[model samples]
Target: MKRASLLPAGIPIGIASLAAFATAMIGGTITDLGPWYDSLIKPDFTPPRPVFPIAWTTIFALCAIAGVSAWRAAKDSRTSDTVIGLFALNGFLNILWSLMFFRMQRPDWAFWELCVLWCSIAVLIVYCGRLSRLAGLLLLPYIGWVTVAGALNWEIVRLNAPFG
Candidate 1:
């Protein structure tokens, strides 16, 4: 394997993962965001606050790993096609969720946005599975987290809807 090939294989995953990590930390940094979050009446299924960062970090890492693997597979095959497209789609949805929820402070809009994100994630998972089984597996945690986040978003919207 040429060194250049390895670079191509690894770069997308590494770059995307780092971007995800930064976003997660930045999202965590909005100091009083917690109070805003806490004030909302969440569903009983909502996990504790601390769990989110930890879970996101792990999921992002997995996504990066999967990206690298898929990239390597694609590079070897001389094309990225579906694998790369799916990864890009998933990333777009991920960032959109943050922008909708935190920046816009629109949980109602965020709730609907998450549905789009969830669907994109599902498509990514199935598409990644076609390219690499490990890549598909890497998305499982992300899908799970999004599912929970979706429910939380719904509850937040429901609770805040009347007033906001």
Candidate 2:
């Protein structure tokens, strides 16, 4: 691929990822995340509050990198179109999960949305693995975190259901 084209490939994905990150951060600031979140009954396995931002920043960076990698490798036969589609879907779903969970503060709805997010991530890993092992590996923490998040969401739903 031409050098110019390669660079631009990162632009779209990078912008989208950055936008999502910014939206989440801004939403976090504007909303009453503390009271809503703190009032809920959390699980014993929950990580520290400070850990969330760090983990999410890392995951968002990896997500951008993966998109760039996939876009750059688009011409490679190994990078199937289906993989790209799955990646795009995962990105869109990632944004939605935060909106539903944090912004809306709907634990039950968030739990269901997170289940879809988890499944999409699993499929994305398999697809990206075929294109670039590193890309797939990059998303590992994201997948792990989301899996734990799903469990937490489930527990939250069970414990704080009907109102929480």
Candidate 3:
């Protein structure tokens, strides 16, 4: 038996992990749980403060795994490049949502932005699924969490409109 010739194993995982970490850090910085956020009327379903970090950490780990799996499974450089590009775009959108909601204190803006995030996730699921079923499946939890977040954002906007 001969070893298969594919892209170096660790590179994709490392790059993807680094990108995910950077995105997480940026989003975390933008997410201020200060008086402004605490003052908002959150939905009863809002998870405890501790839940956010735990949830995002788990999701980001899965994202890195999914990206690496998809890249490795790609048949050609073009496909792998596409996967990388999508993940990069998703990271940007992820940080933007945090900036809009937490930094800007505008859940209304973030709610709309969440729609774009949801679509990007959908694209990842579909395209990654095409490359690797497990990769696509891994993204399911991310989408579910984002769906909940979107609903929560919508509720916050509804509960407390006219944000300054």
Q: Pick the lDDT winner.
A: 3
Check candidate 3 and list the clashing pairs.
none
Task: Name the 10 consecutive residues with the lowest summed lDDT in model 2.
Answer: 1-10
Provide the clashing-pair count of each candidate structure: 0, 0, 0
- Compared with the true structure, what per-residue lDDT tens digits does model 1 show for residues 1-164? 53336465457666767866765665555424666656767778878878877898888888878776665666444346556577767677777778777767788887888999899988878767777789889889899889988888888787677534
Model 2, span 1-164: residue lDDT tens: 43326455556676648764774565456445577888999899988988888888888788777655655555553454565577667766777777777778887997888889899988777776666778788888989999998998899888888854
TM of each candidate vs. truth:
0.80, 0.78, 0.95
lDDT of 3 by residue, 1-164 (tens): 11113446686778888999999999998889899988989899999989999999999999999998888888877888899899999999999999999888888889999999999999999999999999999999999999999999999999999887
Q: Which stretches of candidate 2 lie over 4 Å from their true place?
A: 1-31, 76-85
| Deviating ranges (above 4 Å) for candidate 1 | 1-13, 26-34, 75-82
Work out how many backbone clashes candidate 1 has: 0
Better structure of 2 and 3 per lDDT: 3
- RMSD to the true structure for each prediction, in A, is 3.2, 3.4, 2.6
